[model samples]
Target: MILIVASLCVQILCAIHVIRSSRNQIWLLFIMLFSLLGCFAYLMLEVLPQHWNNRHVRTARAQVVGKVDPERAVRDAQRNLDLAETAANYIALGDAQAIRHRYADAESAYRKALAMGPGGDWGTQVKMAGVLFERGESAEALRLLDAAPELGMGSERDRRALLRARILADLGRAAEARLLFEDVIERIAGEEARCHYVAFLLQQGDRYRARSILEEVERRAKRMDLTQRAAQADMYRWAGEQLAELRKV
Candidate 1:
């Protein structure tokens, strides 16, 4: 009888060890094989600790949510700005200054940043491009933007590509710009993207194609909210009015 009891105790200890080690499947298998001993081990280790930690983490997160403040956000932004200024040697101080909307300061910073390197860093390039655009140097901005790739850099890359297409159209390279806009629409695959593409078509006086694209965009926008629906309707109405004006011309 003592030998049987010793065997049962050994099985229970093994089960407990498996549960504590995070081997749930092994614990389950042993419980099924050893019955009551396995069940008691699981109750002691797996179930209790899992519930305890989960509750603790949730409580900690809830407390953290209450500690956020505007002062903290301001400090974080200032820290980021300082870091960006210190680390970005390849770009001009003028460019950095421009990013913060200090146009005169940005112009000086960009010149300095440009002097740091011949090959462009994405941030510096974008800053320079924006300055050129603001100064009405659209051609130079287009050239710089065209040379840059449009991936891996987040929304900045998408915005640059879209802006480049718009500038190309403005510069009378409508065919090339239209093709580029179409590519962007294909890549992004959403109602907003399609609406922009349709607007571009309408701007180019291709009313028929614009109408078709607008119809598709409208269909997709149905799955969105009333605000989105109203915006799309406005786009269509504007496109129609523009098309009519073009016809009169």
Candidate 2:
């Protein structure tokens, strides 16, 4: 009788835990139906796995959600902003809005982040410039990029240069844009930069060079690690689409 009572107590405790965790309702039934065994199974199969999921799985899920509902992050960031309107949170919101193609909203968010500070946030400045570029405000984008605080030599500088190249391309400064693009393409360039370079070459009637660059990008994409592929799936997809269009030409 004591053993049965202990089993029932364990089952009840497990049920309460699963409920509080907001886990599946089926877990409650399993615990109630099979007592201790059900509780053990539930803990092993669901609870433990939830606690033990690796970074890759979590990151993959986040990337999937970002693609599936890009606005989800924006909503989350907005909630954080409502809770505490911090500069970082506003930047996060701006990033999410930009990802969702809400350039106006993103610009507003970045401006809010900038206004909260003493001055000189190169990252936020770059982001706002990107939004402006997307909205076809290329001159303003150039101004912002030129005004950005120098962050020394590295990915940050490369990204700022890339933005400048894009603005130049849109402004029909092909010679300058091509030079910057070539400089960026020498290193481990992002897919966007690679694709833009290919597009630039195509515009100049350099089909062979454009095709070679696109082929290299596609080849590299095919060899990316699981985490990298997940993070860059959209860029790769866009590249593939562009490649198909190029091939058809």
Q: What tens-digit string does per-residue lDDT give for candidate 2 at 1-249? A: 999999999998898898898888999999998888899999899977875566656777888887788778888999999999999999999999898899999999999999997788877888999999999999999998888777667887887888888899999999999999989877635677888788778888888788888888989877777776776677777778878877988
Best by TM-score: 2
Q: How far does residue 113 in candidate 1 sit from its true spot (Å)?
A: 6.0
In model 2, state the lDDT of residue 245.
Answer: 78
Cα lDDT, model 1, residue 120: 55
Question: Candidate 2 — which residues are off by over 4 angstroms?
Answer: 1-59, 225-227, 244-249
Clashing pairs in 2: none
What is the overall TM-score of model 2 with all chains considered together? 0.72
The lDDT for every candidate, in the order shown, is 0.62, 0.86
RMSD to the native, candidate 1?
A: 14.4
